[model samples]
Target: MKTSLKRFFAGVAAAAMAVGGLALGATSAQAAGPVASTQTGSLTVKAANGTTGHTLKAYLVAAYNSDYQAASDGSLNFDTFKYVVTKDNGTKSNDESAVKAALTDAGVKASASGSASSAAEEGLRQLTGQSAGTPFGYTDGTATASAAERKFADALAKKLTATDSTKWTPSNVQDLTPGDGKFTADLNPEGLYLVVDTYAQKDGSKSTQSVPMLVGTKFANAAITTQPAGVGEVDMKNVTVPVHKEVVTDNTGKAANNTPSYNIGDTVYFHLSTTIPDYSGYAADPTLSDPTGKTIRQLNLDDEFEAGKFTGTKVVSVKDATTAIGDQQGVLENGKDYDVTGEDTDTVTVDLKRLVNGADGAKTGWKTGDVIDVIVSGVLSADATTTDKANTDAADKTGADSNGNSNKVTLNYSNNPKDNSQQNKVPGDTVNVYSFNLNVHKVNQDNNPLGGAEFKIVDKADEATPLQFTVSGSTYTHAKKDTDGAIETLKSGADGSIAVKGLKAGTYVVTETKAPAGFFQGALPSYTVTIAEHYTNDKTNTTRTSTKSGDDWLDTLTYSNTPDNYGLVTKDATSPSTWTVKNVKSITQLPKTGAAGIAFFSVIGVAVVALAALFAVRARKASRLA
Candidate 1:
């Protein structure tokens, strides 16, 4: 009975071993099967306005059991899946937004909350195919997923949504959140399309699409505006041309008669006549106005004309037998003589009537038809006689007569045989009578007078001798000297100088009308000075003790001390010991002299010289005595 029981148990044990081997074989086969790949999708986006394009792809895999997780099993159960969206011209935001929108429109239920791997898987599943269980096999599932993904992509491309496109203004699309599966607004549509990539546990996938957005419209019309034309106006008026006139002389001391010429001493008048145009009235009468506008109607020309004068005269005589007159005499032209009795004709009778007619000297003074009368007079050499015998006898009585005849005749005529030509009258040459005009205008305008500002006459010593300047009128002023020996309108202060403020740049004569008490007015130097710009303190103070007429005037004053002690003295050699005139004079005379040790040393040399001289004298006497 025991042996039988052992056989049965052994058989049972062997059967158990066979069953375990079969189970081990089954597990190995499952591990060795084809790996199941988790699918992923990628998104790509493109921008129109200088932006890049993007693309997205979907990767699908067949479902597998969890036992196929090992490599030997050839099954892949993805713990983490990655979906990459690349932007050509667009940013990651744009790619993400485009992908989310694509999935949402395709009826994909994207979870608002999930891990990156779970979200990626969910998004891929939605893009591939609807969650409906379709029984076709692994290939069928892949085809369905691909078709669905393609449809989703096609829908996204049809809208032409791109970054930087005006039409791509999506609502609630500002920032993209990871794993949220929502659209982002950070899109730029400048260039290229969007690219989407997906990574699965066992495989990778991708998709691409082109974005069409209006980029050229942003800068379609750009140009600058045109400007308007311009015109200019100018004035047309008379431009005055200057006329210059000068006097020229001939060899003879007298002015040449060619022109209405006059010697330097001759009374000559200047007459200017403009053709009155019959419209504009003749210029007001000619008058001489001084620089101060003082007019003189009858100014004596003699005062200014002294150089030209006839110093002396000589007489000449002519005598001949043919002419009844025995002798003829007249004033002789300088350096010239005439022979009356020689072959040149001692007597030639001048036809006055013919001379006047041929000479054309009738016209005179402004009127084209007026006639001029000429007069000639001179000392005669002898008395005249009608009979030729008597004329000859008179010519002989006077030595001025030729042929020793006393009958010499002096001739005078109204009409001479000279002086008629256009060249006779020159501009500025005074005729017997004419009309002219004169006009004078002030160039500088008047300025408002400022009071308290002093006017001074400065000399070379820079002495500020106060003078009064009166604002007589707008343009004129009178600077009169006062009884105090100083001028009025000038301010003299304790500083021993005058201060002229607000005075225009010009020349002024500063005079001292009143010297300080006990000071001799005339004894003080007066200066004739000029107040130059930028020279004085701009106030123009003459700083000398004298009047404007003194010689020791200075244009500028160097106080030597500070302005506070300007007129003060530190020492006094003469009376009134406390800072007296002596001290001021000494300081002014020798600027280097002072109470310092250097001044004391200056006298030491004189003392030493005197002592040496005394010793030399003593030595000389001793030598002589010895």
Candidate 2:
């Protein structure tokens, strides 16, 4: 198998005697016997050379003429198939006696019982596998081999059962050679074949086992389809699982998908994806191929989603990334290729499994550059209503909070490091949906803080009753939440500020029911307090900002009280942070102390009596004159 180019060329005439092999330069398809028109592919690792325990090896077996018979439970059984070999002239023979006579008449070594054909015959039987006589027996009533296959199996057993000195002269098969972190093979597609690969830490050890076990079922890596004629094409695209999880929100109804401001019970549309390990040059590693060391068996993905906030069912898809439109294979069924074996309310884990093809008996490996996208249709729980920062650091909770929520997606696999298992994880960005808080500040025209002020908040347009709150330590919680009660009073703190928590976007009204000690009506005027999504130019500036998305919204809602009026304090138009408020000034003044004052006094006189007497005198004189 390790013949050099020179030796291959020099002995072309002699090597042509091989029943399955063709001339070194032969390019055309054979007509007499099934040509090993094989094209090879290598399993490679990305780790650097001389790295510890990162070695690789490959195993190949042909599944020719043997159809994989599947069971009701998705298990495999090969249905009985006749040993029919297609000739170059399109003539096929299934009868063992007829096949022997035909090959003899054609002047060829039809029977593979020859000493030189021993290796091939042995290799073929190993590929067919067993059933009745061994644990991996091929025929189990559901799947059994024909007479020709039995003979083939007997021939292959020679290699496995042959004595140490007579085991066809060697115990090793030439592995794919390494080239720039990759390996290549040109396989002759004579009969259907399977390719399996493994790796180990290649630090010059002639023998070492690859980690996590690479022993796989014979049917697992078989050729997927009937091999195509001409040179086979194998394209491997290099792509990694993108680490930056981008979650753009498309909220419905009043749902909030943005970070730190979400409403409870809202659905968040989240998606995460991952990459398949490149198994390009794995065959060359001795650790994986060494009959004495551990070998790679299968590649699996371990992804667990947070359970606290992401609730309900989920959607997962396997996609081929090489195409622009994202060509997708059929959706995988749960308990088929994956299982949620031990899942609960707070944790869910899906393990991608390795399975065999029921049709071709080909074992499965992930396609290169292929990624899996999981559509997590998660809903925020009632716990989202809390004002506490998100439990982002908690490895247990999966709920969305003020700090946002992220999915800790992880990938667990084997063979890349050869000696032990390895893993790589990518974190999705947090989605934040947050509520608002209000701080009502009371001040005077001079910007002086004044306490002892009382106010009532109501739905301005509807004049609905203000919500009531009961005091508990430093907290004032909502008490009676009806629509027609007396407006609950809110008193300013010593600093003239009243903190209102847990509010949403809408318009509210704050009416001063009682003012500080010396106010005119002992009350200040009412003003509309709009708490919508208005951006803020500066934190200290009371005026709202209206810039763009992502800009600061309304924060502090400051109010000022005076003798007969009350209004909000705003930042100076020229200076963003300078607080300012406007109200009419009141001072002592002499009442119309001029002509208007004198006339008003003359007419008065407790003075309605004087006016009535004058009117009576004038009436008597007028009557006498008449």
Candidate 3:
């Protein structure tokens, strides 16, 4: 296993040819092979309690073989990992038959099914035009694989197993021990190597560990930007695994009665949470007055959301996991405590210079399971979509059709012990703010839609102030109560249908603010809708107003109706939930303007005839007397 530091690295011509087309990539630069050098730096595996790297071996994946440049694209950069993970998609099984055939043709005994792995290797070499038994690990540029091997990079997955084939310089290999997180290793010039910490247990088994990658030339004071410190250094660069944050209206367990759904004119309360870094070498300050201290120095977290989805003005509350509702004392003030910035106020940066500082005690620092909660008070806007990456077009917004509107939020925080620059930060997962919608339709006795019907929606049963609504991307959206814009008035659409969207579950009154033209206002009274829709725990249903998450039961709605002037009206099922007014006119008493209304005309006619007869008789009598 001993390798010459100069020969293994300097053996430019001795190393085997790389996969030209696939895993090696179609890029000519990658195909050209590693650029070797003689520079070396100290690499260490850092663990919570300072566990040694044990059996971890650093496999040289690529090499520039030159002096290390600060910003130069190192062969082992993030892009290389991406290519290996995403692009060089090939399965070792693909070439299994071909390899076995080639091995059989070459009179070699091997099997891809595990009977004899060497059989598959020999077959690969035979097909790829390499020496019969070219070692599976990185060797001097001597072995060669066929162009087809690049197409099936994953076919070599079996060959790439085992750490014995590592191409480490003799000087860089160091023995790792527990409680000794740091191990110094000298590396050759410009080359990229995959260093895995294989911790060997007393039982003779090995385990892998997580550690950061440090790219420094001389190993002086903080050479490159992405440093987790010797203490915080673990894992790859620019390639971060984000732990998605949670967006909840209320995490107070219903003591706050936060509703997940928002009315058009209701201010939405959003709470965001991100986990704290877990560094094991820390002591909890025994005194409750002091804060907890850890290995971290400067902590910075930048949270961002879609611009228009949230109002420009925000009332933000910050608190750590240490607070309880009864105490209600852990609320930290913004600006005075943390430097908050972002033109639209959709983004906030919390500078935890003093917060995460371990100097104070066990009182104010972060730890495992400890969360930093950021409560942002913003009104859901007219232009909202589930994937807040972009705004929805007005034509695309529909009440029932509205895909759940959401706010896009991301978290980028410092990963290094001391380095707080953007370069040294790890990106957390994106959290989504979700809200639902409701569609409404106005129908006749036949349950057919009619236009010109005006209605009003109010949180209270009185239907006092008409809920203001606006249309965006063809969808009707309501705003919060305190919003400055004009609220939307409900009027039947061209198709005799209207929707009150972006509404949280609550009881609301739908009043016939204005009846449709050509139709007398039906005796049907206003419809009272009670909708309670939000995330609720099953047991907390009694204490809260909302239904369980995924429960469709909004508050019950009651509508009052009276017979129209024509007759008594009855209800029939028009839609799953439609109100159709059926009028059965069978009048027992004549209307004031009906048959009784003409009786006066009949009397007038009789009076006119009687008067004519009297005139005639008087005339006759006068003539006779004359």
The candidate maximizing TM-score is 3
Candidate 2: stretches off by over 4 Å? 1-111, 116-429, 458-489, 505-507, 529-568, 571-626
Candidates' lDDT values, in order?
0.22, 0.35, 0.38
lDDT of 1 by residue, 466-539 (tens): 42333322211222243133234443333322323222223333333343443322222222322231111111
Q: What's the best-to-worst order under lDDT?
A: 3, 2, 1
Tens digit of lDDT per residue, candidate 2, span 139-237?
A: 221123222233332233233335653332221233434455444443222222122234332433211222211111112224333321111211111
TM-score of 3: 0.42
Worst 10 residues of 1 by lDDT: 228-237
After TM-score superposition, the amount by which residue 390's alpha carbon in candidate 3 deviates from its true location, in angstroms, is: 22
TM-score for candidate 2, residues paired by index: 0.39
lDDT of 3 by residue, 14-36 (tens): 12112121223223323333234
Off by over 4 Å in 1: 1-478, 481-611, 622-626
**Minimal lDDT window, size 10, model 3:** 81-90
